[model samples]
Target: MALLDTLHRWAGGFVGLVLALLGLTGAILVHRDAWIMLPHAGDAQIQSTHVLAATTERLMSNPETRPQSVTFANANLGLDRLDFGKGAGAYTEQAGTIVSQWQTQWARPELWLFDLHHHLLSGDTGETIIGIAGVAGLFFVITGTILWWRTRKTFAFRPLPKRLSRPAIVRHHRDLGIVAAPLLVLSLLTGATLVFRPISAVFLGPGAPATIDTALQAPKGPKVALADHLDWRRMIVTARARFPDAELRSLSLPRKESGLVTIRMKRPQEWLPNGRTTLWFAADDGRLIGARDAASLSNVVAAYNILYPLHAAKVGGLGYRLVMTLSGLTLGLLGTLSVWSFWFKRPRPVKVRRGVRP
Candidate 1:
């Protein structure tokens, strides 16, 4: 118990507070896409890539706007983000550029929610601080697990005591911590992985015939325009034929001046938001290039790769979302309880009336 108290005291602080906030925000971020205001989902038959290409070309011609990116959804729906001027951008889903923009801020409700998680919208400082907090939280959770081990048999869900006393603080501290410990461990460990990629990369190496080291080394194909050799339409046709039930997922326009265009698959029966199989194509002449299969990855690496999508509840749909949301609230409760326990332990000034005896 003495040892547990020491560890707990060291673990709870401002860094813990930041981590608590980051975790709370992170949980909400998991289902953000479903909640954030965006244009409606698209139809079954999305338009051809070439058609979007024409619109992109026209949008580019206007000097008033410079295309930052053009994303394909489907025939009736798509998203275009443009650099109108400065750091500003507009989102256009329907054909012909409509000026719909969101200000980049920390307090814009949903965007603020995002800011609270990533940057506190404080830019790099907040990001770095949050990253450090995640590390602290990892330490806290691990230490907590060790502490809980001592009280394992006696553990049961119990609320804090009504009175302010040493025993009351102890009960509140122990019981609440025990109840939320499992989720704390999960949320913190995953949160830590998101902040520290190297940690994740290392964890991804344990259970495989070959390490994630091999997976990360996937060939950096010589620079070539992926669009040139592949036809986006034909690639789509082949992909649809291959995974007929799959919906049109996000597309990655060719990155290499000489690389291929990439498209992902989202299946109807599956909860995977983005297909793991990326179909690569020649960007210039539109030819089927290659399909990179994630399933082929060693079990070790595949487990590591699931961190983000799982944490964000982006993988398993509503069920996962509910778990994530509840986990987040639990973390928030843990933070408040820890802080409250600390405050309750501190000595308070005794009440004294002017004529009262000492």
Candidate 2:
């Protein structure tokens, strides 16, 4: 028991700051659409196929300014986003007027904050560190709960420590940790699973990862060069004709040697902000090559898809966003205070006079 307590304290001291940063950033990111103050950002989403097709055609008409991809407006944010690759992008109105353009993610708080929260700004290495921190945080929650059991009778709810003293902080930590354990578990597990796909097997069952990989594997066929002036409108119209119930979510140009344009959509039934229902078209002649209905995915894969929405509060509207915001804030508070208590609030060593008394 003592060893467990010591390990928890030490682990908290080591990874607490990282967890705090992730929590605070995640909280802010949950309201990204609300806080991003671009022109027409708050305008209501327009899902009319004519408007969508015209706007997409206009944007892609200019090869010089054409983005590699376009993420369509949703109910929360009315601006379409264009990704030009290499950290360059712009946001445009539904009518295809460019509102804001950036050469790099540094020019936008929302972009960099997302990058920081997801990758710690160090790419894959930082992502691995974040995954490690999430694992440590889970350990803290589980072991903290066990340790709290000993003093459960003395539990008192306090949002903050009544005072800065060690004992007070410890008590606050215990009570708050217990109060926020469930939320913390949900947030941490979903987050860690995103970075480490194999972990999904725990919640999604064995072979789940393999199943998802097989299902999502891109088509293998003879590759062709992308046509200079493919019919963007026709492609959009065709996709809409096929999935009349789904909202156009995103469209991506083929990458490298792959000659397929991918169109993604969100159905009303999907919890993922960008629903997995997808259509693939040959880039050379814009012929429909394949499609996948997200709703018809394997049960395990379907359950796996809900993790992002659950973690990021992408669904459930304002109420769920607020719930997730509270979870993030609570995690931040716990991590920040845990670090302080473990490092700065330690007991001071006692001194004795040399040979003065025995």
- In order of appearance, the predictions have TM-scores of 0.69, 0.97
Q: What shift in Å separates residue 207 of candidate 1 from its native position after superposition?
A: 7.8
lDDT of 2 by residue, 1-358 (tens): 9999999999999899999999999999999999888889999999999999999999997777799999999999999999999899999999889999999999999999999999999999999999999988899999999999999999999999999999999899899999999999999999998898888888788898899888877776349887788899999999899999999999999988888999999888889998999999998889999998988888888888999999999988899999999999999998899889889999898777898773
Give the per-residue lDDT of model 1 (tens digit) for 1-358: 6876576665674455666676678777766544535554332344454554454455544434434344445322345444333334455653435446754543235456876787776778887777677677666666766776877786666554556565565565566666676766677666667665666655554334245556634344436643222333455577666665666564555553636556676554333446565666565655566765665656666676666666667655578678878778766656665666666566578988898797
Which pairs, if any, clash in model 2? none
- Candidate with top lDDT is 2
RMSD per candidate (Å) reads 6.0, 1.4
Residue 31 lDDT (model 1): 62
lDDT for each of the candidates? 0.59, 0.92
Model 2 clash count equals 0
